[model samples]
Target: MTDAQLSPLRAEVREFLRAEIDSGAFTPDVDSWMTGFDPTFSRRLGERGWLGMTMPTDYGGRGRTPVERFVVTEEMLAHGAPVAAHWIADRQMAPGILSNGTEQQRRRYIPGISAGTVYFAIGMSEPDAGSDLAGVRTRATDNGDSWTISGTKVWTTGAHIAHAMVLLARTDGTPDDRQQGLSQFVVDLPHPDIEIRPIRSIDGQAHFNEVVFHDAVVDSSALLGRRGHGWQQVMSELAFERSGPERYLSTLPLLRAWSDHLREHGATPNQRVTLGRLTAQAWALRQMSRQVARELSDGGKPDVFAAMVKDLGSTFEGDLVTAIRDASGIVPRREGGTHLERLLAQSVLHTPAFTLRGGTNEILRGIVARGLGIR
Candidate 1:
């Protein structure tokens, strides 16, 4: 569907967010997850049938298309809603399962996910491997009925609060095989052998955690797909990763809030032009993202196109923060005008991860280049 077609749903999501704001479900002057974790907010969203709106209705999802999902997500981020508590679970893991999981897996997991009864974290980035997912040395040894896993994953977002993790480990052969030996498993994180230690970020938030898996036993059923096919599975998942409106829309609420504040104070023509240009760029990026969602819904992988969206989306995200700071004359500190202060603090603290998370800007450009047959 076109952006024009998505307008009605966007309006509906905006109304939903307005109610959340009125009820004080989110703070107007705090970083999304910095203050603390809030499960009640997630339950509220789930109860509204908004949590897994993209999954099939048989599994407790609303069965909406990705375009509709995009509208909900975009509105949430644009309003600066504190979705980080269930962010990785909903955005990455749940979608991954809905796309690639078996019927049993879906029946077992998706309903709980939709009900906010189960939460998941991603176990992809490790201490030694960061973005080089192929270099992940975490090993999972098969024991006929289950796999015994042992390794450390850094930057495992919200591991402490998560019940399970979609973990990637070397399973089949050797690391030299690159894509051949890797596999993805859904390991229960609250087990006795699994350890989770919070890693305090510069923002003074412990949302990120270092997870250690020592003899962490996972059932054979925990394998997300066929063993030794993790590279392919993760690649497909990245299409979901990069295609979402979150890639570019996370900071939109702050930008708009700042813009409104500046206009109320009688901004100059230059400031007005800057805001207009930024808003226009954001709108264009949103359209590109919606196109990728359409492609996904049509049963085609838009890998190349999704890469382009992420590359441009993240660049625009950083640029949006910069423009807002410049135009609104706000400093990146904890104290400023009340709303501007919160936005500046959030933009300052979270902007650094924009180019690095999901996939790095460098990696995305390479994907685009390869798609053009230039690499």
Candidate 2:
């Protein structure tokens, strides 16, 4: 169906968000998908059948198309809803589990994820490797029917409160084996041998963490996908991860706040032109992301296009923060300030990570180059 046919669904999500705001359930903020962690709000999305729009109906999902899920996700991020609680699970883990997880794993995890009551964390980065998934040093020892993992995963997003974590480790080879012998596991959180230590950011939030597995044992069933196939699995997952609306929309709240302020206080012609250009750029980026969703739905792997979206999207995100503040000439305040001031403050602090997370701009550029057979 064309986007026009999805108008009703889009309107419904907007209305629900309207009701949420009217009831004082949340105050819209910038980069909500990254920073907002309201479990109650996430549960409310689950109750509305909005959490698992693309998973199988057999697993409690709505069984909708990727485009439909795209519509819902675009709305949530644009409106700055508190979706961080279920973001990872619903966005990537559900599809990962459905694609490679065993039937028992699906039955046990999918329903709670669809219900928004269960959360997951990404355990890909290690202290030594950073965003280089291939340089992983975290190793897991095979013990017949189970494995004993003994390594640390750094920058583990949302591991503390997560019900489970999807971790990557070197299972059958040494760290020198870049992409070989790597495997994934579904490590249940709060395990006796697993330690979660929070890492605070410049914004004073522990959204990132360090997850150390001290000979932690997991049944062979915890393995995700096939042994030594994690490189392939994770590469595909990054295509999904990088091309989402979140990439371009992280600093949207800053624009919204500034625009709202302009509506009240008025804007000069130059400001109007700048805002118009930025808004137009955002619209173009949205269309690009939406096309990637349609491609994924059609069983196409547009990783190259996904990389473009991420590379340009993150640049847009960081530039947006600078543009809004420069256009207004208003000082950003960290606390006890106007809505625009506070939002700008948050955006300024977060701008540093815009190009770093998911993958660095340098790495993303190389992906694009390699995709074109230039490297």
Candidate 3:
């Protein structure tokens, strides 16, 4: 689709975000984007038909292309809206389910997801198996038509508020092999056998959780794709996860706010040079990320290039936050109700997680190096 086709939707979303900002639904002072979590905000976006624009129409989706969805997502992040509540479900689970789920699964789960009535958490990274996908030991035992699962998942974002979890586990681990017996399951978070405890970050936000699944029974319908396909499924999902604007743009509001502050205060010579450099870097990264999105929309696996974007984008994020703080020569306020103070505080706390989440920067660089035959 042409850029023109995406512009109108982008404008429409911008208007909606402006309205939300005007109504005091959220404060623009902080990275209003990442600091808040409101189900109502999500449901409002859903009601506007902006939540699941890429899914099919039958399951409460709008049947738009990835590019269309990209326009909506980019706009939401740029406005610094509190989209974390529905971000995972919209970005990864919905697409993964649609790609690998049965018709019944889709019919049962996706409509609520599209409507923003349902939420999901990812149960991938465990306490012992942070970056190692092949090391997950969550056990899913076969019990005729259903399965019983038991394990712990750490750093699970929104588990306390999520309706379900797209989990990875070992269904049939044998002594000879580990990857041979992997699977993905949709475990209901509110089930009696499950527990979710908030793991507050350094910023004093309980955005992450330690989730324990004990004998959580799921029917056969909960299985996604096929048995022993977790490796391929997780890889496919990461393509969508890593290639998005979220990687670099999560900190956009902070950068923009800093830029605005610099402009309003009359930029000095040093400030002018720093601003130009940061602007160029942000612009180039944005273009690179969009290219990866184009590849994803074309149904091509942009794994190698996507890894590059994630690695570089993460570095850019850490560096940007540091540079803005250093160049401005201003202490990030911790007490003010203004947007700049909140942005500074939130960035100081949340920026470290950027390199750790999705995939660690080290892992991403390894993939890129291998793809270049540099190993």
TM-scores for candidates 1 onward, in order: 0.94, 0.98, 0.96
A best-first ranking of the candidates according to their lDDT comes to: 2, 3, 1
Give all candidate RMSDs, comma-separated: 2.0, 0.9, 1.7
| Candidate 2: tens digits of C-alpha lDDT, residues 1-375 | 797999999999999998888889998888888889999988988989998888888999988899999999988988888889899999989888898899999999998999999999999988888878899988888899999999998888789889999888899878888999999899888899999999999999998899989999998889998999988888888888999999999888788878888899999998998899899999999999999999999988888899899999999999998888888999999998787898899999999989988988888899899999996
lDDT of 1 at 80: 74
* Model 3 TM-score (2 dp): 0.96
The top-ranked prediction according to TM-score is 2
> How does model 3 fare in lDDT?
0.83
Model 3 C-alpha lDDT per residue in residues 1-375, reported as the tens digit of each score = 788977888888888889888999875533333446788988988998887778899988988888888888887877788887788888889989999999988988888888888898999998888877678878889898999999999998888888989999888865146567889998876888888999988878887899888788888778888999987898889887887888878778887887888778798898889888988998898888888778878888888888888888878888888888888877776677667867787788787788988889888888889989997
Backbone clash count for every predicted candidate, in the order shown: 0, 0, 2
**Structure candidate 2, residue pairs in collision:** none
Residues forming the 10-long window of minimal summed lDDT in candidate 1: 28-37
lDDT of 1 by residue, 289-313 (tens): 9889888888888989998999999
The residue ranges of model 3 lying beyond 4 angstroms of the native Cα positions read 29-35, 174-178
How far in Å is the alpha carbon of 157 misplaced in model 2? 1.1
lDDT of 2: 0.90
Of 1 and 2, the candidate ahead on TM-score is 2
**lDDT, candidate 1, at 337:** 51
